[model samples]
Target: MDVNGDLVHGATLTAVLDGSTQPVGLLGALSQAHRIQRLELPVHTMLPVVLRQLMLPIMLDELKAPRDRREWGDRFNRGQFSADELERLEHYLGPHGYGDRFRLFDAERPFAQVAGLKALNGETKSVAQLVPSVASGNNVPIFSALCEADELRLEPGDAVLWLLHAHCWDTASIKTGAEGDPQASKGKTTGNPTGPLGQLGLVVPTGRTLYETLLLNTPVVPDGLAPDDRPHWAWDERPIGLGCNSPAAPAWSQRPATGLLDLLTFQARRVRMFTCETEQGLRVNRVIVSAGDRLTRTPEYDPHTVWQHVTKPKKNQPHQRPRRHISGRAAWQGLSTLLAMDLPEQSDGPYTSLLLRQIGDLRADEMLSEHYRLGAETSGLEYGTQSAVVENAIGDDLPLPVQALLAQDAWLREALLECVDQADQAARALDTLNNDLRRAAGGDPLPRDKGSKPSAQFLQSLDRTMRRLLVGLRTVGADESELLERGQLAWEQSVWHAATSDAGLLLAAAPPRAIVGRTVRNGNKDFVYRSGKASGLFRARLTDILPRAAEERRAAQKEGAAA
Candidate 1:
């Protein structure tokens, strides 16, 4: 498929079945010896999730053989597979096995689709809807040149590309209602749930080599297959209309997932593409889209999300839920959550992904090194009311040292998490400074964007410094407690400087009225708002917020008493 002017090779069932598919190369341009220089469609964050989904079943298949999970990881680290394993993988993925049912468009069966969808819906819409970027229907083109007027056309390959994306990350909106669903209103279903991936602030663990990445993301399954578990493609019988096995039950009905395979290959939406034989070969012109399976509850074992204990619970059972990513926020801002492990019992806190914990085990075993940099790539859609429209598509990659991945709340992880909190505190202090300056000038409270810009910029300035601190921490030895303290202090100083710089800006921008002084009511007593008072307040807040600064102040006060 030619996406963004680059040709991406599509993986075939045959290649995947024979264990010949190089997923890294398929997703990006490969350098000599099969190294991915950079990811193609870098903003297409769902691709990695989909790729992982594809490879996981294969991993499960391989583990079903007589071999330890550690042995597989060791072989992956060496970039070699046993001949017996290769043969078994082929048989497992082949047509003689599960691959027989994996078809893109078959008369009797289709991959991730209701076979008679068009006939059931009795309508089809332009294929432009498949491509999220292209404006179609009532959606006005914001950045895209193509609009409803433009001849929106897609080749088979591109159609498939977007088709997969639709299943994983499609926006929630009104959809065509199939015949079997009981929830349909006039042959339509409104308020549909967003694709499962849309619900997560997905963080995928990436490694240098494709083999290593596959193994890193694939969790170790000690006991092989659950008897009834299978991916969507491996289902023996086609799903009938909007129902699963039950003909009367609607597809919109919520149910618990059978296993990881079921969750990954879940048909989030029922879709059918109509193709035409053109001079340019087969092209998809129209498609039908509707809701597929909706999850009953968020899966606790989903490996791609950072989990945090819910302070306020809507339900009593799940103390944790996947953290949602904020738009325009750097991944490092959530470093504490991303690197967090289990807290001491009785202290329920944020935790890293299960897959990441597995990767940490690899690092502990020396299969991966402390200095070996890995990346945490995050992606998710920010939706408007009922997820009816796409507000923003968020995607970012933060390269992290292996020290951050150490198990059981490693020292580096704890230290980095503390620095992140300190940074947050500093940012809040700076924000308070800005608001106080505005108040002194007799100005009303600033809008959210204007008020928060200073703090946001302050954090942005600390990005490189934070990364440098991470690098430094990677080199620190376990016995070097004092060295670690010094490093933490250094990081605190960076935060101090960043906050004060923003404070300086606020002071410089202070109005003449603020300099002269203003009297304001302080709970029935008059209080003065002057430049000096504002500066003093800022300094006091900074001292309280910064640990090192506070310690220094306490030491000076104690010496003064001694004198």
Candidate 2:
């Protein structure tokens, strides 16, 4: 306690977040545990301070990887890096710190604690903004869970939804209605702000609770739900008994699914964090978002709804098992986002919207089928998701892609979807012909101007990006498989040309194939060398040669250090 009797508290962020009980994680242990109430402090106010401290170190890590580098102490004393890696590192993490005051040990800090703050701060605008905002244009959702008193509420059974729907209540005018008002002719009066919503539960303000309870009705876990995103701390809804960790392990096992998880980068956004007494000192536990409330908007979604889930600083059942609080709707939303975010910036807007709709609409059989096509192992569901089902999902029609596919078959009947030899005359001729045809068919044509063409390097990058995107957008009937193959081939060729340019190799002498260097064996003695490999490996005395080179490199490093 402080001199004035104010409570002084401190905490350590765990290496990984507690998946289940973290009311803040994607799927919390309790959708309706203890509602968030009676806070030690407003979460929004504390968030900025927390993020500011967390981001500084994470930014520093991107500046340099500390554990690998041998040098220590001051920035000048530390070693250097290539111009390219250094430039890239600065482009994202910023050059404000440079190498000054950055320590090698700082990079070794737990990533989850430091890394997630940037997203949270960006979403809430909790961080400092002295200069004109570079992030003002960003479409991040504004965080308002902590700003208002009695804003967040949990109305059980969705009876409020029935009343509101029946009464034809305008959602925009929620604050204006009263219980006995002559609002008119749905044969019912308008719903009150603080009163009952028909037969459902009352609009209870969000309160805090120590224990999160997941009322498990069925043993079946859903398919496409990512266990990696689930809580590692979850225990069965049973008594705290001994021998739980016996039988080689506990009765439970957790294997993370390889599906969608967009909130991984911005993890803390899903979690509701607060400090309270645990068996092991002050631990952070999150509040789960409860469902069944339909009359009032959820706190997180409503910017106008000021109240948030409350706090429970004291815990009576510290050893109680953290069970799963399952809500089908929230779980589905979380999993759909996770699956759709397989590519860069995929979580943003119409792209993610399209993907989520498509994935959610796919059957479990279809998901598994698509999973195999994406080059993942289809051995078995073994991840506790074997019984998962996608309910009432009908696939959406993709008009543009369908049109593009139909025209591709109709106009360019020559099948230019070949995946090799971009530099060959026949391939170039086909490509030019395809472009002209695509233009005639009102599709995206290859860019051309002046008497010259785009560099092979540009063609490669564009083709690669377009291919990955086009492949992801593939539906059950779309003929995108061959298209994607061609794209991959183009990207590979572009990368090859770029590398050759970098190495200053003679483009005329270079063969079209990735392989180079003629076999020069001494009178048929069996030996092979592949110049196409990432590392040059002459495969005869490979073991001896590599060891000797390694030894020499170590010696050189030692000599350099000694000097």
Candidate 3:
């Protein structure tokens, strides 16, 4: 599919637009200049009935061919799949209908397979292996990608980050040619690009040593399934992406920032290849890509000292456990940095007081810190008391009646108490969100986008207020910006409140008897609100408390005077 998610078929030769150019250039290959031999179809490959009907007679007549055959009959042979009509297929029909048609995107990206850092054994080697070195039948000898740190231009001695691509083929050799030296024979045409030999390239950053290219294709037989097949499959071919390696491409070039989508598509394929591994016994564990670490013994050292030095949990630390480590931390970091920009938009939060409370609670769980690699400190918080942190967060976001309370001595205490009440309310609001988060943690992390939930009692109310305050920024109306802004505002406000207010004091206060303030239970993390005043000095009626109004009302009214 294109960037906009439109589907592309064989006929749709989507123009590769070069955004880096002054006027974006649509890439067109010089198909006329470079004549490619039309590859013959495999004898065993069951072509769709229509194609077989047309090509079978042609295949039988290799000795006597028509001159116009290259124009039409062998267009599919040369991998020219341009068509105006869509060819529907039903693999279940077993060639009664067309099936498994070839698709070529006409997009050839050159990726280098760089090698030759000193091996773990400290053996310095000159040779670097870059695989799939054949870029559209031309041997790529050098890569611009390896030449500089975020710069264009190629040079020798550049530390190149390359994909050690290992691609496997079902067939041994479709097209093999030789001319001069083994090295010289590279650029010269070889192997049939369009053949039964399906290729798979699993890429991983080189570790302590250059991995030896190995092919162990365990012929996989298909399972007849109306069945529940696990990830571990019975196979005719092994999950082998590490098939070959080559030196730097002779010509290196930068994939411009504008070509990020292309880069992502390429790398995502690499990720898929890397993740497909040797099938395990019954239960196959999925490989999740993250940072990569180096072997401590290697001369070409990398930071992963933690990975090397701390292979197991520390002594007497029950909380710590050995887990997965990244292969190339640096490479992974760089890759992730590039990919992060493409990630979906996220709401800025800590806007609603509820979120901070959740974060604080998550931190207290201890397991959360371990899961997220947040040592000791919880997410966004460190070393401070959680209660104090929550108190502060709520204070920053709470709207106090500043103008009305400014002259009064009792304002500070009253505002503080009000904040405590808000905290209690926020806690209840967080319940739905907490439930959702907990459900997510329990593994149902899907439906990447969600609708605006107006049902959240306290959170929704707070968001409404935040939206009203943020009316100046709204172009479409406060609802849109506020809806988005509230989450971030919540966090920011929480921070402001935490730094400036004593709202959390209400948290420790006993529950107010009847909705004035109260305790709300959430397992161990209980929100304690200040209890309501009962017949206290501050609760006196205005007539009883004030002399002037009290005397006037007393004289004007009967036994009961309005206060």
Number of the top-ranking candidate, with lDDT as the measure: 1
Q: Write the per-residue lDDT of candidate 3 for residues 190-289, one digit (tens) a residue.
A: 2222111121111211111100000000001122111211110011121233221111111111121111111111211110001112332111112111
Better of 1 and 3 by TM-score: 1
Maximum-TM-score candidate:
1
Cα lDDT of model 1 by residue, 59-114, tens digit: 56444521344665566666534566556655655557654344455555555556
Q: Could you give candidate 2's per-residue lDDT for residues 1-563 as a string of tens digits?
A: 11111111111111112332221211111111234221121111121122222221232224331221121122212122335534554443332522211111122221121212122112322111100111111211134233322222211111111111212111111121111223322322222221111111111111012110000000111232333321111212212431121111101111221112111111111111122344543322222110111222211211011121223313642211111112212211111222222223322221122212222233221321232222110000001112111111111111112212222132211122222222232224333433333333333446664333323333343444434533443342335556545444444444344433422332232244324433334586832322333122212222232333345546879999999
User: What's every prediction's RMSD, in angstroms?
Assistant: 5.7, 29.1, 26.7
Q: Residue-pair clashes per candidate, as listed?
A: 0, 26, 51
Tell me the TM-score of each prediction against the true structure: 0.82, 0.20, 0.17
* Deviation of model 2 at 220, angstroms: 5.8
Of candidates 3 and 2, the better by TM-score: 2
| Candidate 3's TM-score | 0.17
Model 1 quality (TM-score): 0.82
> Candidate order by TM-score, highest to lowest?
1, 2, 3
lDDT value, residue 519 of candidate 1: 79
